[model samples]
Target: MTGRRIVSIWFPRFAMDRWRKAHADTDDGLPVALASEAAHGTVIDAVSEAARKAGAKAGQKVTDARAIYPDLVVEASDPGGDANALMRLCKWARRWSPWTALDGADGLLLDSQGTAHLFGGEAAMLADMNNRLRRLGFASRIAIAPTIGGAWALAHFGDRSGIIIDDDALDGALAPLPIESLRINADTALLLRRLGLKTIGDLIDIPALSLARRFRKTPDATTNPLRRLEQARGRIEEVAEPLVPQTVYRAAQRVAEPVLHVQILAPILADLADDLCKALEDGGRGLRRVRFEAFRVDGHIAALHAETAAPVRTPDHICRLFAERLETLDAGFGFDAFALTAIWHDAMPARQKGLAEDEAEGLALPHLIDRLSVRIGVGKVRRAVAYASHIPERSVVWRPALEEQPGVAAMQAPRRERPIRLFDRPEPITVIYGTPEGPPKRFRWRRKLHDVIKVEGPERIAPEWWRERSSVRLRDYYKIEDEDGRRFWIYRNGLIDDGRGGPPDWFLHGLFA
Candidate 1:
């Protein structure tokens, strides 16, 4: 396999640029600084280029910066907002490569291994990214290398904005860079500098054991210099988890005239759904969850989501689900664009239409479940499936009806009877006549008294022994019918003083309907 290629885009003034964009209308090329409260009062966290040229710098006291430049614009630094904006940009960067992740608060990493050829070459791709970001009011440094660590170091510290370090020249490209570029902590960097290790080349020839012994106080402490060196040289593998996109199949349409009425959305949604379904069909997939997005002319967005019991490729079915959720969407003034996306999907091969009427009728249940799930949120519609555990409570599991559930036939056969409705936590009841191992003749449950008309079982269940330090006590269950013909499944705690606890307690575990 060919070697992996990684690209790092560093936004040196991300926070300041975001602030500038938020106040673009009022900004008139004045020096700006984002300030945050520090131990010694407010200090500059980030500064614009104009502010940097005017004797203002990060870590400088706000009052000192103001004294240096009287007209400097000061804005409170919002680290969270800056991070969120960078994540949004990471989402937008998916247009260039699907594998893109946030490097830090002000940087992004893209795995463009096999994707660079799509946009001519790595150089062209970097140029395009630079141009687009520049247009978006962000000054970014783009660097491509054989490794993530190398790309990151070059992007932030290299003299060039667009540097492509080839595998053959990896050592030469990184040799002249400062030790700080190795991504060591400030304290470690300071220590390395004090030791006269000013460049990456200075540390490259040092013994790994010597370096570790000098820098690390304990044997357990990580050897940062050696690890960083290995990563930059592409010796150690780096794994990056990219941010998941909301949808795989998406279709959007921009309208010349804004749509104000909900009635007009049906046809638009149908058309978008059809397009999305067609794409799904071509990819041999079907949608399990879908979302409809409306971008308003007033710069607001309204969204509606729908889920299905099974993967569905039918456009009409998808449109119907959106139709049910249309009223929930507030279109604001008017919608200028509409987008339909299949957020969750799965591979679904085409199945033949049932030849027999009964076979075709069997499919209606899933469709009904889908409709109900869409109507009353997915969480509200649930189904019960047999669980593998022998314990009564652990023998059954409840999950969303729209989700795929394990078949009952696949589970171990129940050795004893189980109630139809099982309470999550068994309700404690007062027994009138019962032994620690016997059934109760009369019980008080939920402030209601019930006299036993017929008694059945004394099925004993023991705690699973394989589990480590199992605290579960032994249980003796009984199925009894009351005077009103109501049946219940009740159980007693541990055996009468089995050296576990005090007297055994009774609990109404479930009700049989």
Candidate 2:
């Protein structure tokens, strides 16, 4: 086809086919029918091949059908169950084309505009599509044409199903089809037939003014044949929304047979990662998160997800993330199809690579964090976030790296120089103060004595008088460098002769980088 190509698929016995597929152990030759209650009586909603051969059909009363065939197996119809399964099937159809959606309750619509070449050609694409559906235990009638309406018409009423119609031949191919192929309801079809308009050709020849007067002018008038005719002729465009929105970065694989082990999926997973990453690189974007879906033949999907600490387009990094999640993955009845998509992404502008493996500027921090997250868990890796407090321990809290810590407005960095490393609990140290309320001259810690070469501060920190008892003591913090140039953060616990304590004691709290 020229501009755009579409594929329409219809399931003639959708409910019955799905039911039989689920119960493969049952006798295939037995007659089966799905019946639902109606105002008049219980009616057959769908029938299997055996049931149809026994003179049973949809819309026929259950009693009447049973009258013709005494051994017909009757089961309650499940419209809701069929619909939910169909939606999943629509998503699974993405393995063939990203642009896929439910055509109706028992069909699918796909845009084949740019995807045909990937499957060889339009014919090979249809063959692959048919083979996959058949393997999944579905019976389908599919057709490809330049427009949605044309494809739908040909799939349902053409001389042969699974035919591709070129744009140049769409009119000739659609002319001989019955008016009901336009997808109008029975009443509308009956109305057209009564007016001697029995074929699409007849309706096409009718004057536009006459066709307009015969139907309502409102957009809700789905019974309008004129619109369907225009759509089929490619004069009017019909929009088909995909089950999953399109993404620039995606890759998928379909196997001829279902795979049973997680180990067997490694190469396929790697290939998908490489394909997706290549797409991201070409698009000038990076993947922040990706969704992995494995479609099983029984219609159940097994899904897993992974994300990065920073935007990335590396295949090995992406593969490693998924590898961590594969051990516990349950491959129910195995999987026949697999797909990958970068659901969340960010702009990854090109940059020059540096030769240094150790980055002092912290350029490699994100990669390190990502690796740690994968090894332990995505949620276990955390960083220190400062909070609004004066107490050394209360000044910051540990939180997950990916999670955004709440309001830093009330929090501020310490204006004073602080050690990069801090102790959870202060250790007691022996100190000789030059005088009362003065900085230390020497200190003994871990059984080693160190002479002070320089002293910076007696930064005063008052006790929380509101929350503490009258005995709570204030603190005098000092920044001192020993003679060897090794710095230490030590504090005097109380004032000398203060009512709160007999004498101030010194403790080493932290170390400088």
Q: What is the TM-score of each candidate against the true structure?
A: 0.47, 0.48
Tens-digit lDDT string for candidate 1 (1-513): 117788999998889888888998865568888899998899999988888999999999999989989999898999999888999999999888888999978899998988999999989999999999999999899999999889999998999999998899988999999988988777778888898998999987564445644655633213377667767777665666688743379999999988888888999999998899889988889888888999999988899877787788888888888787787777768999999988888777766556643222245677788888878888888897765456777666778997655222223676676788988889999998765457888989999999998888888888866541465678888899999999999988887768878888899999997
Q: How accurate is candidate 2 locally (lDDT)?
A: 0.83
**Residue-wise C-alpha lDDT for candidate 2, range 162-249, written one tens digit per residue:** 8998999998999999999987888889999999999999987765444655685635435888777877887665666678765567
Clashing pairs in 2: none
Model 2 segments more than 4 A misplaced: 217-221, 245-513
lDDT at residue 83 of model 2 (Cα atoms): 99
Best by TM-score: 2
RMSD of candidate 1 to the truth, in angstroms, is 16.4
